[model samples]
Target: MMRITDHPVLGPLENKEVTIQFNGVDYIGLENESIAATLLANGIRTLRYSEKERKPRGIYCGIGHCYECRVTVNGERSVRACITPVKDQMIVESQGFQS
Candidate 1:
């Protein structure tokens, strides 16, 4: 959803296919795109859950203004997927409240 295919000024963005893992499953994503954007392009929207309510949260305020898109990246918690670039073979896991 966030990929810039064609812009009036930037024209186009060039990206190559990349491999990334999400929740133990490997998926194909574009290089240099944000983790949240890649996940959204793959139709996976739930990035994390509310700390208390356990409600599914995703790319809300995608510009990094909110924590709704936070997820675990490479065993690190509280990583904001919406702004974090997706690295090839990067590991991403949905974050849920510790219960």
Candidate 2:
């Protein structure tokens, strides 16, 4: 993702890079960064789809207020990616009926 190398006040981010599995594909992300950020960095903006219209949905509101960024983590469903931290070997799946 577009991580800030040095936050003017917080200094450099030392979070180690970790590999995460999204939709069966491997992607690199910071250990502590949000899953949503990691996916967005990898050009994966469509997190899910609208139930009725079958429209693609991504990050909205960004603070967990909206459930547009929902996804399946490991074996858990309805997990919010915007708030979940990425970890090594974490398996994330896009929530929808498409695949």
The digit string of per-residue lDDT tens for model 2 on 13-79 reads: 4579899999889999877677888898898999988788888989997667798999999989989
* Model 1 residue-pair collision total: 0
Best by lDDT: 2
Scored against the true structure, residue 14 in model 1 reaches a CA lDDT of: 51
Best by TM-score: 2
**For every model shown, what is its TM-score relative to the native structure?**
0.84, 0.85
Give per-residue CA lDDT, model 1, range 6-95, as digits (tens).
433334445788989999898877776778878988889788878789988999887777788989999999998877877888999998
Error of 1 at 10 (Å): 12
Candidate 2 local distance difference test against the native: 0.82
- Report lDDT (CA) for all predictions: 0.80, 0.82
Q: Taking the candidates one at a time, how many backbone clashes does each contain?
A: 0, 0
